[model samples]
Target: MSDPVIICCAITGSVPRKSDNPAVPVTVAEQIESSHEAFEAGASIIHAHVRNDDETPTSDPDRFAALKEGLERHCPGVIVQLSTGGRSGAGRERGGMIPLRPDMCSLSVGSNNFPTRVYENPPDLVDWLSAEMAAHGVVPEIECFDLSHLFQAAALHADGRLPQRPYCQFVMGVRNAMPADRVAFDAMLTTKRHLFGDAPWCAAGIGRHQLELNEWAIAAGGHART
Candidate 1:
């Protein structure tokens, strides 16, 4: 039998704001509230990203600690997965937020242009990030945005950096990268072909294609969001 899927509700992400969805929470209290709501909605895990007063992305350990405490008290053992994808080029956000020592944290396995800006994580930085996760005993959730990125992730695994059965978050459909269609779908399949032996992966499509890619992942004998 296939393993049970882990549904991770990305409650209030860095990109989404109150204007987009009035229910999108920005404050610590509101975040807790939204998390509880998602929990009740059948999400056993949460993919979180913290925001500052101005709603900018912030890797504040205190904020993470507060969320952890609230989850422990109210949710009672729900997994909190943090995003290492910083808003700006400051690579510090990923390592800076490590004091929380979350059960799982993301590792964007490759560099890609995010809209007008580039999200850089070259080989050296990736190795460092993986080693840090290992040192802290936290599971690295490999976030792959392209086929080559998946290969890169496998390369890291081969070099004895990533875990034995690593977790993957395959992102599809972004500008300046893979498109969001059957052609993009094939690329994801290519990724699976390479990384399949090394990990259990969950997939997501950004922007308008989120739902479609998610469905593809669910149908293809992989873990997926409900």
Candidate 2:
């Protein structure tokens, strides 16, 4: 088999207190600059979110469009994957950003609570978004917060809501989500069990679990970048 592909950077995510990482980009320029840095580091694909002027997250179509224009201008052929599960707005509200026609976008296969609030995604909403995305020619990278998310992914595929060659990102180590272990191999196994054999998969662990799971995902015949 050919070597698994590598995703270059996760880029600037939505959450994470500014105090934690001053490098987290919050504005248009910052997001683009960070994308450039990550692209140069050998990342051909990026998982991205748009932030407001004050460093808060927003899924504005204009903002997403701007990023698309800028990234394509500077780095052509770099796949910019937009995060549909934006932090601030309602998940459905965030869907408005789809007009930008990103090469790839996220699809949260399940929901879970994070610290203060709940991240909500349901079947109807998922089905609607998946259909809309297909019409727009956008690829969905199913985001899995836990094992159950995998089930949802299967169901979506079975129902013909999602296209084949499903792409999933196993986000382990969040508070209520799967724990991120220091053992890379263990993390890989946990992901593999849910993903089945040889599906296009990526793993991430927040906070202290980040590096461990990331490295583990990369070594375990999966691609790792952000």
Candidates in order have lDDT scores of: 0.75, 0.76
Superposed model 2: Cα runs more than 4 Å off = 1-5, 17-20, 182-196
Per-residue alpha-carbon lDDT of model 2 for 1-226, expressed as tens digits? 3775676587787876467788777777777888888788778897888878777788888888888888887777899888888485675776876767888888886778876767787767888788878878899888777767877887877768887667777777778656775453465456556655667777777778777777777777666646
Q: Give the lowest summed-lDDT range of ten residues in model 1.
A: 86-95
What clash pairs does model 1 have?
none
Q: What is the C-alpha RMSD of each candidate to the true structure, in Å?
A: 2.0, 2.5
Model 2: pairs clashing at backbone N, Cα or C within 3 Å:
8-43
Q: What is the TM-score of each candidate against the true structure?
A: 0.91, 0.89
> Residue 152 error for model 2, in Å?
0.7
Among the numbered candidates, top TM-score falls to 1
> Over the stretch 5-42, how does candidate 1's per-residue lDDT look in tens digits?
77777777688777778877888888888888888877
Which candidate leads in lDDT? Answer: 2
